[model samples]
Target: MRIRAKQLAFAATAAVALLAVSLPASADVSGRAVKIGVMYPLTGKGATWGKHAQIGIRLAVEEVNAAGGIGGVPIKLVEYDYQAKESEGITIINKLATRDNVLAVLGPCFSSVCEVIFPLLERLQTPVISYCSAKPGLSKLSDWAFRNSLTSDKQLAPVVSRWAKDYSIKKVVIIHDLEDAVSKAEGSKVLPMLFKREGIEVLDILTFRTEDTDYSAQITKIKSLNPDGVGLGSCYQNAAGIIKEARRQGLSQPFVGGACTGAPALIELGGKATEGTYVSTAAWMDDPADAIQAFVGKIKARNGNKAFPYSAPRGYDSLLITANCMNDNGITNEKGDLASDREKIKKCWANVKNYPGVSGSTTMNEVGDGAGGNRVLKVVDGKYVDISG
Candidate 1:
């Protein structure tokens, strides 16, 4: 049942009970709906994440419109494909802020892109909430900048500590991507510190690039150390490859992943190798709570009965929080001005507290900018199950 993200995203055109928001379908007030731009890598190597994000955003749009259309003003999504390139992000944000004049922006899902766009926030005053960026200092770069997903430290620290205490893990090894900010911060700094606090010995640390296809050297080191646990800070594909290689190299110690690696693709790619591995993330797709299940059901029905992607929850939550901020601040189409009301929405997002969603509750923090709930997930028989305490 291996499924590509684009397939998971667009297989079923089965219309949701609610309507999908697109570009200015009927115009809200005066020949234009309140525009919110969505930027993602819809056509490149990382298009999978973009597609997953699109489905989640579309579901949120449907939910928002069903609930009387974001303060009686129907929202329109201005979607763009930056193909996961940071340079493209600069161009897209410039266009989204200056030309499209969208009130707020969502996505540009990579932290690499976030770093490039952080400077644009002060120049444009447009609030941006990233669904996948987990680097710690991103939100602090600007008052208008925010994040919907939990940073690596927030998502992984407690869960890893709990797992170590419960499993009596005394020694660990970390394999990380040196070229990535999120990966470096989590693997080289946060996870090690958390392990140290738990009295776990870090035997060694290893590095790889995002583009490396062969992990034989790293796998050999992991096999040699054979610590009580193996920690990973990597993209889904890289994590899967590493897990497969580690298993092939006879490294049987349990593996734990940071926030970004918690996705269906991990198991889909690693198969039996990923079984029994655990990862921590902001959203728990296997949650049984009514709100979580209902949201999952909608996505399944719309995606031809396939399992939901991890990114969907954050994308859906991002929209809900953004709309709630608008409602809380009373920033509406009453003034019939998108640019003027953008500042008010930004202010509201800065002050948002206890904003709940199917993914996790989020709050605008002063230091890290934004953070949310977290869960530790273990892979059993090729499926991710909530195992956090």
Candidate 2:
């Protein structure tokens, strides 16, 4: 009987030892493994931009994983191609939240899509860090939908007005793609106000659809108004198309625009036709930061002589933010728990301060909004040249 009792006690002790080895430290609870849902336009019209955003995101994930996998447990990135549709984006978000049970989500690109999906995410209490959506109404839509990109107001409006005054522009015309929500919002909300504030007459405000590449009609309309300058608030493709058509129609007169104007596509697609066009963008390749320069080199090398666009920096910065958030929160795989970990991550993200990102110093505002400042670049000699602001 004594020997039998001794054997049973030994077995119990061994079981306890095994359990201790298996369980992680109590302090490591917040370092649990997590799955992040990344929704982007991996295919379709927004695919090129979305692909760039995804590359940065994955690069961030790779760097984090290399540094010992957020908290020791690996972070699984589950991606969904929303194809640039709001309804599809919402569906993907729902799947990420409910079926896949992701801790967080990345993007749906367009502001209009973000506006639509934000309500659903708010209801689910799912945290989303959108990459590029910058509509004014986004912050008000929900606490859950956070944006790292700058609002068009802060980045575009001030630049446009300042440039107008500096150049002594007496007349201006704001032409945009009416089908695009972001462009429409920028034109309608800021056109009248900016014209009034700058004391510049808006000779005409014109709209065109994304499908209509032929801008002869729009250019004819704009020429009739005879504006000194034009403000193009649209995507890189559409903006390039408009500029090419405008130049063809001999309507060139100190044309300047926001971020999209300084894209690689403008120069690549429009070639010599894009020269002399100026754009206010959040990124410049000539930045003093070695990191940014190195990244540009890397991307250019990868693309085999293709010029890096302004959007690349935004893409890279978005990943940097995510990786930093994971590091700050002590995210790990050993704990293998996500629900509680996500909550901790959200809190950690709130405290992220002065993080050196590719774009600039990244620190979220009270409402979780951030955007790098704007620097104007002119297409001179078939390349983007920094214009003194």
TM-score of each: 0.87, 0.85
- lDDT string for model 2 (1-389, tens) is 11111111112112223222322322242434557888887776545667767766676565545545544555678998898777898788899988887777888777768878888865676778877766666766777777777777666766666667656788988887676667777776755566678788887788888677788998888888888888877777788888888889887676676543456777777877777776666666688666766666756655665665544556656554554454444444233456555665566555545555665655667777774576766778988876655
lDDT of each: 0.74, 0.66
> Tens-digit lDDT track for model 1 on 332-374?
4543566557877777666666555666666677743556667
Off by over 4 Å in 1: 1-30, 43-47, 327-336
* Candidate No. with top TM-score: 1
Over 4 Å off, model 2: 1-33, 330-337
Q: Tell me the lDDT of model 2 at 329.
A: 49
User: Over all chains combined, what TM-score does candidate 2 have?
Assistant: 0.85
Clash list (residue pairs), candidate 2: 70-331, 70-332, 71-331, 71-332, 72-332, 72-333, 73-332, 73-333
Candidate 1 residue pairs in clash (backbone atoms < 3 Å):
none
